[model samples]
Target chain A: MITSGDHMNWKDNLIKIAPYVAGEQPDKRDFIKLNANENPYPPAPGVIKAIEDFRGADLKKYPDANARPLMKAIAEDLGVDADNVFVGNGSDDVLALSFRAFFNSDKPIVFPDITYSFYPVWCEMLGIPYRTLPVGEDFNINAGDYNCENGGVVIANPNAPTGIGRDLSFMREILDANPGSVVISDEAYVDFGGVSALPLLREYDNLIVIRTFSKSRSMAGMRIGFAVGGDTLISALRAAKDSYNSYPLDSVAIAAGCASVADRAYFESTLKKVMATRDRLTAELRAMGFEVPDSSTNFLFAHHKSRKAADIYDFLKSRDIYVRHFRKPERISDHLRITIGTDEETDRLTAALHEYLG
Target chain B: MITSGDHMNWKDNLIKIAPYVAGEQPDKRDFIKLNANENPYPPAPGVIKAIEDFRGADLKKYPDANARPLMKAIAEDLGVDADNVFVGNGSDDVLALSFRAFFNSDKPIVFPDITYSFYPVWCEMLGIPYRTLPVGEDFNINAGDYNCENGGVVIANPNAPTGIGRDLSFMREILDANPGSVVISDEAYVDFGGVSALPLLREYDNLIVIRTFSKSRSMAGMRIGFAVGGDTLISALRAAKDSYNSYPLDSVAIAAGCASVADRAYFESTLKKVMATRDRLTAELRAMGFEVPDSSTNFLFAHHKSRKAADIYDFLKSRDIYVRHFRKPERISDHLRITIGTDEETDRLTAALHEYLG
Candidate 1:
């Protein structure tokens, strides 16, 4: 008995929900492109070769719904059984599905207040009640804060924007406190520095670790991400994924992901290069009177003592250098998150900053 | 306070829901893949060229979130503005998003009982109530059946497994009767013969027409689908999509989609070839005493008077020829949905059938 007006009013839950705003992807290609934390190096040569060798006749058929080849590759690389893995379009898609499958409870879940912004958006969209636990003044997650009763817990290791990683023992504390609740350790940036909670999966049935190829593997445009956990947890995600979209990864992505995982030497060399650049860039910024954190990831979070964070961001942008600046959660309003790029790109960023400040 | 046992229990709704089962994609490479109704021809040469030309450096960066280039090409091809379009990973993803955005009302939506089996799966996953109206003895959707009060209406043009296309006037009648409901015309198979409801978008604000690159464009492995509608409906779908997953299509998919759409000559020639083969296949089946429907699609839905459908399906499979057979809804249980392959493939299928029945 609904009318036109009723149809126009989308689901009440969806109407008021605020969608997550991803980092801006400026149209101009000539810019330094450091805003979204993308890897400066191209993907491994094997990845490019895979796409080049793909046959047109293969595209005439649907991709394997299970993505068995990619799953097998990931399992072999991670030293886990195929049953322990689950893959999706990207970590965003994987996290969204996990929220639907595991986090729907009457009691609220708990997460760090200043973690990945997408966590709150997922809860809002799914109508799951949640409570945000504030991070310490140093912008580090306090494991004790998650000891209370809750439906589940999510933590992004090497937390974004802040770029600091917690020790594995700290993550174990959170998992031990909530033996029944599912504790998701998002290790998207784990390859850069942080000790992955992957080892904890052997002992904790409730631990689910999520990772992405956007950073270390240098395949962001291909859109591949995955989770590793106990067989039961992985099965629930599979059931949910099947009910939603059967073939989330296309054939091309599957091929590219397999090739990237197989070329271990290429991946190791690129990650080492990024880490070296990050250390050098951090020292240069601190010497320029910026309060740079002890970053464990490929990005540096810092603020100037005299210049406003927004001003520095604008100045950098004007010089064709992009960095992320957040306007809300007032505690971190003065901060700027600059992604670590190649040696040349990092040198250009430092030179630009020195000129602007002088 | 949720405890360990409480965490083990999933959402009440998801536990009882049965996920949709897609057409089988067997692991074997030698079989003639007619089960999923995929286009027999390879995608346009431009699609292959796009993949070949993609740079490894580009794969390191995140793809364009808005997919502007592909959107522009689709808009130009469809004679619509960019604001009127919304794209997704695949047509299945597009349909799932639409159900979440538009069909969460108190009243149950209506769809043909014998159409795409995925419709009910989407409803169950989203917790939306829906009723399936039975098709007529002729396997045609009676437009009058949709005159009742409901939240929405969904029709698959050149309906699956039946391959019957209703005229434009009948669709207009349904749209006229359901002025308050959102009428979704899924034109996944419309490129084969049916008149698209795209033209009606000018007159009806509540109409949404969905199209896919999987069918006529022969890019199923790329996973791209889109919808065209009034700006308001498109905005609602956008909100739902952004809330769920921001970037659904990968960069390679966007590039491949644009190339496929731009090659008009290749698209038309391939579609014409498919239609011609479909006609010949239908006549040959009828001559062999099979009850074949007047197909307006790339697939033929037929059944034999004396031979069992399951038997014929198995016989074909033994010879490496795969066709779809549905066992539910009781009405179409006897039918076999066979995708029209190339001329040589069609000859093989007919020859196989003759041997089995003889």
Candidate 2:
């Protein structure tokens, strides 16, 4: 019995895969984790109740692979029909399926170099050739760069790491520039501040707007994500998902996701609270002589430029307050991505930074 | 807004994709659904209670993408190390990932021509060309036929559509013959009657045993599936899953699954009852002059050469007693895949069949 974790032959590229390293979840009591950009608020009370009372034995069977009920709920909330919706395990799953379903094998896909890190990962994993266009000095996407040969397009609204968003005017410009490409608007943070691309789905089958339950709905552990688009695009994603994992979500997930979405009042209130915290935290960080981006998401990307990011990271880690700092893209080396905690946690974070700076 | 779903180029193969259609989930008073093979038993009472009592903010955070906690629970139950295990949304997801990770890109993957309908569907969707190995006159898988050029091997124990299962000696022979290929043993029906291939994992790194909560555990609505193997094979699956959906199960689902697994007494009793019913129903079907397969799963496959499977399916549906009928391979055209219902529901099916035969 020669024990092994890797079996048989594998593709050469699979060997080089540096899979995304999720935040470490230590079992210590003193830790305050701001590593993953997860929502601070719990799911709406209705969602909790639904899970507790969900007595459907049919769940002992496979879930509706089509996720018809969740889609209906999402569509109704977004004021669209079921035909325009597709759902998955998370926004990441939807993005991966979309990449496989729509990206051309011949032409390379295009995305901003500083956008979501997962974009390149998807292209590589799917064997879709792709290129990363550099963001402008203002950290804005250059639509002209993707005017040439293309496969698919991905724009992370309120892009990760930088917290810079691409608004609708620029989004429409890119959609126009790449007439032949599938444009995916990843609105993982849109509800935080940016406008949605869902309304544009009526005009473009190529436009895919991806959203997640992790942020506004405060159900990251529930693992639900959705996409809104024209029928053709939705069909392709549907085909890929069905071919892959028929029941991506179990019965409890769908029940809770539907309940969370239906509680519009809770979602609205949660969103407002997060936005208020984000505004306060951004000002506080700047007051301590740090350069922080005006964030649209629940997190801020900040740097002192004078202070080494690693030193600050070490200082925070010693205090059991964990934030994210990646050693990638040399240009962003000085920055730290901090998820905005509640008012009390933020106050604690600012006080710690004040001591560290002194 | 020049929106189009079709304009974004897809792989030439993606357009030709026709996903497998699961049975209907009608939004009425839940009928005694005998379409998909699911356990009639509800999950452990503790499982329901745990889900109901979940008042944690875990839902607001991301799940452990690696599913470390669930893996530990499964490993502890199986007496295997956590490293030698993997889990996903359902067994179907694990099967799909295995096809790409363990199977070769060059040769045809082998399975029974009359086995689980999803086998060929997966092959077609992944563009992994496959050659169907026809089952014997007894509907038994011939281990000798697998000596040909092989990419990998997959077998649904107590094979779907026809519930007959293969013996351990024959499985050993198949695995020995194809030393280089990955052998996936889907033991979805094992607890019902068939023996598990889990013990074989120590002998072959290529052996992956897929199990589901849908059957014996009665948590199918919770959508949790697991695979047991040597560590290396597990790593490949983890890589594929991480690159796809980080969190396959939500917090409530995680809670439910764990609690269900913990209550061993409940599952043991449920299995005994289901097995007893299976034995009784098989004898009754045989006495009724219907040629029934010796089932090891929760379903029975029966046929009358004179009657078309479609006609029988329609006849049952008209009476609100539904069964699955596939028309692809001509051999099983006269057969119906019927799920084993509770005692009363089985009696109804038997009464309905008696009338149909009369």
Per-candidate chain B TM? 0.96, 0.93
Question: What ranges in model 1 sit over 4 Å off?
Answer: A1-22, B1-23
Question: Weakest 10 consecutive residues, lDDT, candidate 1 chain A?
Answer: A7-16
User: For residues B125-167, could you state the per-residue lDDT of candidate 2 as single tens digits?
Assistant: 6678788899988788888898666677888886877888777
Error of 2 at B150 (Å): 0.9
Say which candidate scores most in DockQ.
Answer: 1
Binned by DockQ into CAPRI classes (incorrect, acceptable, medium, high), candidate 2 is medium
lDDT by residue (tens digit), candidate 2, A1-358: 2123323443321223554567667678877778888888888988988887887555677777777899999999899998788988888888888887887457788888888887877776667898889998756677777666677788888788787776677778877776677888999998988778777776665688999988878888888889998877788888788777778878878888889988999899988998999999888889888888788888999888478988999899888888888778877777899997778878778888999998
The clash tally of candidate 2 reads: 18
DockQ of candidate 2 (2 decimals) = 0.50
